[model samples]
Target: MEPVMPKDPEVHSAPAAVEMSEAAAANEEDPAHPETMAFCPTGWLPHGHRCFKLVSSDRWGSVEENCAALDGDLAGAETMDDYNDLHTLAQFFGHTYYWIGGFYFQGVWRWIDGSRFIYNNWHSQNSASSYPCIALRGAGGWVNTNCGYSYPAICVKRAC
Candidate 1:
């Protein structure tokens, strides 16, 4: 959806019209949460606040359907503590795989809330295969992994 801003012929015109979309609007967001705010390190749909990806090639599953499977979909996580809540959510609800707004794909790790990947809660000997991205091994909690891996990814968005 394109939001029309007030414009003038000289100072601003239709030519100056900016498309508030992913590529155009990207980098315009604040340097807060790195997860949802950052680029889709993994193939997922960015609903601005939430990033979502299909579990498999299953077209039967819609964004709402994926959201329905998650305990915290549109709620919007504010802090690491809030992300902690997703642990339980991903446990029982996820089927094949789900995306989370936490990764370090760009060398510098960050969360959807803009928090740096300072403290990782990865379980056991699991390590980050790729830089700047992480994933959850089903009910095994979170793991720092490469975004290149074939994992079902999810994103976080604000609740309207």
Candidate 2:
């Protein structure tokens, strides 16, 4: 079945625009802090001091590896804002189903990046052992599915 679009107000209300710093606009890299990025990289969306991107379809594991290569991990929704932002990003990109950082591990749900799994937007309480990975439905809410299933994925990393 096709997922439904979210009715959440926050999802509809556009997120605040993030402006690039002067250094970032100049494309200057800081020699003293090579790790610091003034802005998100090309093709990435900047929001609240973080950068996010959607990658092409792949299995959950493969998608995570792809995120790692970009110096990030599968995206996680630790708060309502995070969830709304991710949902909006997917909707904007015209994706129906996309992988997030959630997974069933050690008999508990956890974000791949080791973030606390406190907040959630679960579509249902059904979490069968066979469905170990979490995917965000562009329509709304999160779903547990087989890890081997292929889907586009959202990757996120801190923006310095």
Candidate 3:
């Protein structure tokens, strides 16, 4: 697949076209419902079971503290689709380190969340060997090491 790059950094993805017409009519009727927010699916952190976590908009603690401003330990990127959702949300926010599924255990690139990782790793890329957490770089369109790298990160919460 071709690289999916957004023209505008803070743009909300266009909801699927098939549902647009139906949604337009429904939108007029229920204006303030939770479903109405095009950008936020559930008004919950994940955004329609999509797994979106905001970092550092909270009081006390570091950016990790805000990791769960929307949810707690139960939060996680449930699938590749959900991780992709968080990735897009990171773009909208212009965040530095939107954490997703990647970790190094016994010298292997294992995904923390069991989703099939959807990223292209080049030879020069050195994340799994040196990073505790992974963050995607929009400019290079690659994931990189973030071990001990202090930056804002996104977290995920499971639906209860």
Best model per TM-score: 2
Candidate 3 stretches greater than 4 Å from native: 1-46, 57-80, 113-124, 139-141
Measured with C-alpha atoms, the lDDT of residue 52 in candidate 2 is 79
User: Which model is ahead, 1 or 3, in terms of lDDT?
Assistant: 3
Between candidates 2 and 3, which one is better according to TM-score? 2
Candidate 1 per-residue lDDT over residues 22-135, each given as its tens digit: 652343334574444544323333334444333421111232245456433322234566555555445533433344556553555566556675655555323433233445
Q: What shift in Å separates residue 61 of candidate 3 from its native position after superposition?
A: 12
**Candidate with best lDDT:** 2
Q: Alpha carbon lDDT of residue 74, candidate 3?
A: 18
Model 3 lDDT per residue over 66-153, tens place: 5434444212333455445655665665644344445556755555544444544421355454444455543323354545544444
